[model samples]
Target: MSMATTATTVSLTSVTLEVADLQAAHHFHTAFGVDPHIRLRASEAHSTGFRGFTLALTVAQPTTVDSFLGAASDAGATVLMPAAKSLWGYGGVLQAPDGTIWKIATSAKKDTGPPTREIDAIVLLLGVEDVKASKRFYVGQGLTVARSFGGKYAEFASGESSPVKLALYKRRGLAKDLGVPAEGTGSHRIILGSTAGSFADPDGFAWEAATSLAPTPSTESAAA
Candidate 1:
């Protein structure tokens, strides 16, 4: 008698992280080596690799983790670690509120290089109402305003705490630059780093002011 044979197939899916701020999370992830072309929407960010996996970011409050998990009962997102105050003063975790196990932490013991990464290089831009006022706010928050071009653009840095430099520019103009469609509110998003606070520009462009994490090896390499 002949026996029948069947082949099994498997595919990798996208990984999404629920963050308090979309733009901030984008900034942080970009610094960690995620590409920006994957960001498909204002509220959503994406990154891709040949390894066939994706990373996404969605907004959620720290206190809502339990509720989010409850809704994703079938999705298999378990709390690898519960949400709690981090040693760095912000909420930290090593799990997703509604997905597979992933490392999520608020620490900057990653990048130790000066904050020289350009905004264009990392796809992070700040939208502000008043460039000068925004510059002042960042400076007061411990960032060093490196320079201000004309009266409409400003650059700030936090040294080795982050890899990307922060910028403050006119909101509408920034939207035009990024080719973002006109919408209602003009709030930006940013991810707080272990050593810096994530915030938006005056115009609402989000930014992540944090250090980069070391490059993670591909799963194939581990298997090999």
Candidate 2:
């Protein structure tokens, strides 16, 4: 009898936002309607400026985008870019009270139905110094490339049940898209939940095995 070996693959199972205030972060996310999709960790990690990344939410239509943006604003998120219509779609940018930037967007310019609270996807876009190099690094860590646009962008494939998707973009370009300057220092203040293992990427973003992490937060609690 011959034994078989299987190669392990990597994927983003969840995203953990390290914040200074646990209860406050929980309350904000609960009110913003994103509590079910993310995890929270109490970290007094010294970090400042851009943090080199942004979380993006994709929705069905422009009205949905507005709905999410409104919720975020009401929850105390500072409006970085007011919701507006652009050639690609309608979207807006805001910074959470914990200092993480978020972008809510929709590809549909017109509403086909009444506004919904449904979120189609949550994307974790890392701003890296070198897109190609970072893409190669993730590929080496067992992430299959779902899409790549030269040195400008790259996306990794995740399971259908994945709570979050992963992508890469040029740091300056990402900042420009979010209507902010690119210069940032200190920690990224975010940790990725990975199926592969715990390790820091070349750009300094950290990851931990999903098995070693806490459960996803609910509207009731942020305990991990």
lDDT of each: 0.36, 0.86
Summarize candidate 1's per-residue lDDT along 144-166 as a digit string, tens digits.
Answer: 66678866888654344233344
Off by over 4 Å in 2: 1-6, 212-224
TM-score of each predicted structure versus truth: 0.39, 0.92
Name the lDDT value of residue 181 in candidate 1. 32
Instruction: State in Å the error of residue 156, model 1.
Output: 1.3
Please estimate how well model 2 matches the true structure, expressed as its whole-model Cα lDDT: 0.86
Q: With candidate 2 superimposed using the best TM-score fit, by how many Å does residue 173's alpha carbon deviate from the native? A: 0.5
Model 2 Cα lDDT, one tens digit per residue, 83-199: 999999999999999999999999888999999999998899999999999999988788889999999999999865687899999999999999998988888988887767778
Regions of model 1 farther than 4 Å from truth: 1-120, 186-189, 194-212, 217-224
lDDT score at residue 126, model 2, on the 0-100 scale: 98
